[model samples]
Target: MSESYRVVEPQTGVRIGFGDVWQRRELLGMLFQRQIAARYRQMLLGVVWLALEPMAQLAMLTIVFGFLLRVDTGGYPYPLFAFSAMTGWWLFSKTLMSVAGSLQDNIGLISKVYFPRLILPLAATMKELFDGGVMVVILVGLSMLYGYLPTAKIVVLVPLFAYAALIGLGVGLWIATVMVRFRDVRPMMGLVLQAGMYATPIVYPATLVPERFAYAYQFNPMYWVVELSRWALMDKPVDIAPPFFWSLGFVCVTVYGGLMVFAKTEKIVVDVQ
Candidate 1:
C-alpha cells in the first residue's frame, strides 16, 4: 500500500487540507454508519425512532401553538407550514445537539486512531440527514394530502437543507471545542437548542415578533433556512432573495470559523480530554 508521509496522524498545527480529508473519505462513510447504528442501538424502536420523534414533536407543537394558542400561519394550514419550517429547524437543532460532543464521545477512537478529526463532527451530520430525509418524506406526503402540490420550486429544498447543515456544523464546531474542557456545554446546548426552537418562527409567524425585534430575529441563521424552506416547499409568502444571500454569507463565516477553531484546538482538547 502506498503511504502518505506529509499527512500526519493526530493532525497538528493550524493547517488542515481538504485533499487529506478527501483521501480519507472512506473513513467518513464508515464512521457515519457506526454513528447511525449507535444512535438507535439501544432504543426499542431503533431507527424508526428517528422518524417518529420528529413527528411526535411536530404533533405536540401543533397542539400547543396550532390549537390552544391559535397562532396565525396565514391561509396555509398550520401543520404543513410548521412542519416545513421545523424540517430545517430540526436539521439545525439535531446536528448541533449531536456534534456538541462528537469528539468527546469518540475519545476511544480519537486516542487510538489517526483520522481527520473534522470527520467526527461532519459524520455526526450524516446521521441527521438520514433521519431528516425520513421527516421530509412525511412532509411531502402531507403537502399532497393538503392539496398543496409541490411545484418545480420544490427542488430548492436541496440547497436549503445544505444551508441547515452548515449552520449546524458551524455552531457545533464552536460547542465541541469548548466541550472538551467544559463538560456542561453539551447539556447546556441541549437546553439552548430547545429554547431556540420556539425563538425561531417555527411555532408562530414572523408577524408575531413585533417590529423592534424583527431585525434582530432575522440574524438567527436557522430563521432564514426555515423561511426559505417554507417558501420552497409550500410557496409560503416570505421575503426571500436578501435573507437567502445574507444567510449564505453568515453560514460561510460560521462554518469557516468553526473549522478553524476545531482544527486549532483539536490537539489541546485531546490533551485536556
Candidate 2:
C-alpha cells in the first residue's frame, strides 16, 4: 500500500474554499450517515419519527389555529395549508438547529481528527434535507387527499427548498462558530426559533398581517420561504416584488458572511471546545 499525505498549512486570515470540502466528499457522506444513525439510534419508531414529528406538529397547529382560532386560509383546508408551509419551515428550523450544534456535538471526533471542520455542518444539513424530503412526500400525499393535485408550480419547490437550506445553514454557521465558546448560544437559538415560527405566517395567513406592517415583514427570510412555498404548493397568491429580491439578497449576504466567520474561527474555536 502507498502512503498518502495531507499537507498542513499554517492558519492565515479568513479564507473559504468549498472545493476542499468537495474533494473530501467521501468523508462528508460518512459523516452524514453517522449523523442519521446517531439521531435515530435510541428512538422507538426510528425513521418513522421523521414523518410522525411533522405530522404531529401539523395536527396541533390545525387544531389551535384552524378549529379554535378559525384562521382563514383563503378557503383552503387549514391542515393542508399549514403543512404546505410546514414542509419548508421544518427544513429551515431543523437545518439551523442541527448545523448550529454540529461542531460542538462532534467534539470527540473533531478534537481527535483532522478532517475539514466544514463537513460537520454540511453533513448536518444533508441529514435535515433528508428529513425535509420525507415531509415533502407527505405534503404531496396530503395535498392529494384534499382534492388538489400538484401543478407545474410544483417544480418551483426544488429551488425554494434550496433557498431554505441556505438560509438555515447561513445563520447556523455563525451560531455554531460562536457556540464553541458561548454555550448559551444553543438555547438562545432555541428561543429565536420559537419566536421566528410565530413571526413568520406559519399558523396564520399573511393577509392577517396589517397592511401597514406588511412591507417590513417581507424582509424576513423565513417569510419569503414560507409564503413562496405556499404559493407553489397551495396556489396561494404571492407577488415576486422588490422585497422578494431583497430577501434573496439578504440570504446571499448571510451565507457568505457565515462561511467567512466559520472558516476564520474554525481552527481557534475547536481548541475552545
Candidate 3:
C-alpha cells in the first residue's frame, strides 16, 4: 500500500498572500456583510449611529480643545481643521481596534474554518468604508459651511484612506497574532490608542509642537497623514521632507513585516485559542 502526505506552508511572499485573499474575494465579501449585519442587528438607530457617534465626539472635542484649552487652529475654523484630521484618524484607529480583535472575537468560527485568516480583518475593515463615506460627507458639508469649499486636492483623500487603513492593518496583524498567545495585548492596545491620539496632531495643530521637537514628531506616521489631509481638505501647508519619507518607508516595512509574521503564526493561533 502507498500513502501520500499533504503539506501546508506559510505564505512568505506578500504578493502571494494577498493574491490568496483576492482569490477568496467572495468569502471576504460574505464576511463583510455578516459583520455589518451582526453589528447593527438590534440597534435602534442602526447605521445612523455611525454618523451620530462622530458628531457627538466632535462636539465634545470642540468644547474641550476648541473652547476650554483654546488651542490655536492657524486661522481656520477649529471644527473643520480638526474634523479633517479626525476623519482619517478615526479610520486608522477603528480599523486597528477592529482588525486586532477580529481573530479573537471569532475564535469559535476560526477553530472550524479553513479560509484565509486575513479575511476577518479585511472584512472588519469594510464597515469603516461606510463610516468613512459618512464622515467625508460631513467633512465636506462642514468645510463648505466654514468657507473652505472643495478643491481638486480633496481627491488625495482616496489614497489617504488606504494609507490610514494600511497602517492600522499592519499594526493590527502583529497584535492579532500576538493576542492569541497573550490576551493582555488587546487591552494594552487601547491604552496605546488613547496615548497615540495626543501624540498625533489631531485636535491641535502641528505648530503647537515646539520647532526644536518638530523633527522628532515627524517620526509619527499619522502626523504625515493628518498634515497631508489638512493640506488636501483646507489648503493648509504640508512639509514632505526627509521625515515624511522616513515614516513612509517605516509604514511599508511594517505592513509587509506584519503579513509575514501573521502568515508564519496563523496556524498556531488556532491551537493557542
- Evaluated with lDDT, which candidate comes out highest? 2
Instruction: Please write out the lDDT profile of model 3 over residues 93-137, one tens digit for every residue.
Output: 999888888889988888997888888888888877767777888
lDDT of 2 by residue, 122-215 (tens): 9999998888877888888999899888999989888899889889999999898888889998778878898999899889988899999999
Off by over 4 Å in 3: 1-16
Write the number of the candidate with greater lDDT, choosing between 2 and 3: 2
**Candidate 2 structure, TM-score to reference:** 0.94
Per-residue CA lDDT of candidate 1, range 127-217, in tens? Answer: 8888877777888888999998889988888878877877888888889988888898776786888889878888888889999988878
Order of quality (TM-score): 2, 3, 1
lDDT of 3: 0.86
Which window of ten consecutive residues has the lowest lDDT sum in model 3? 8-17
Clashes of each: 0, 0, 0
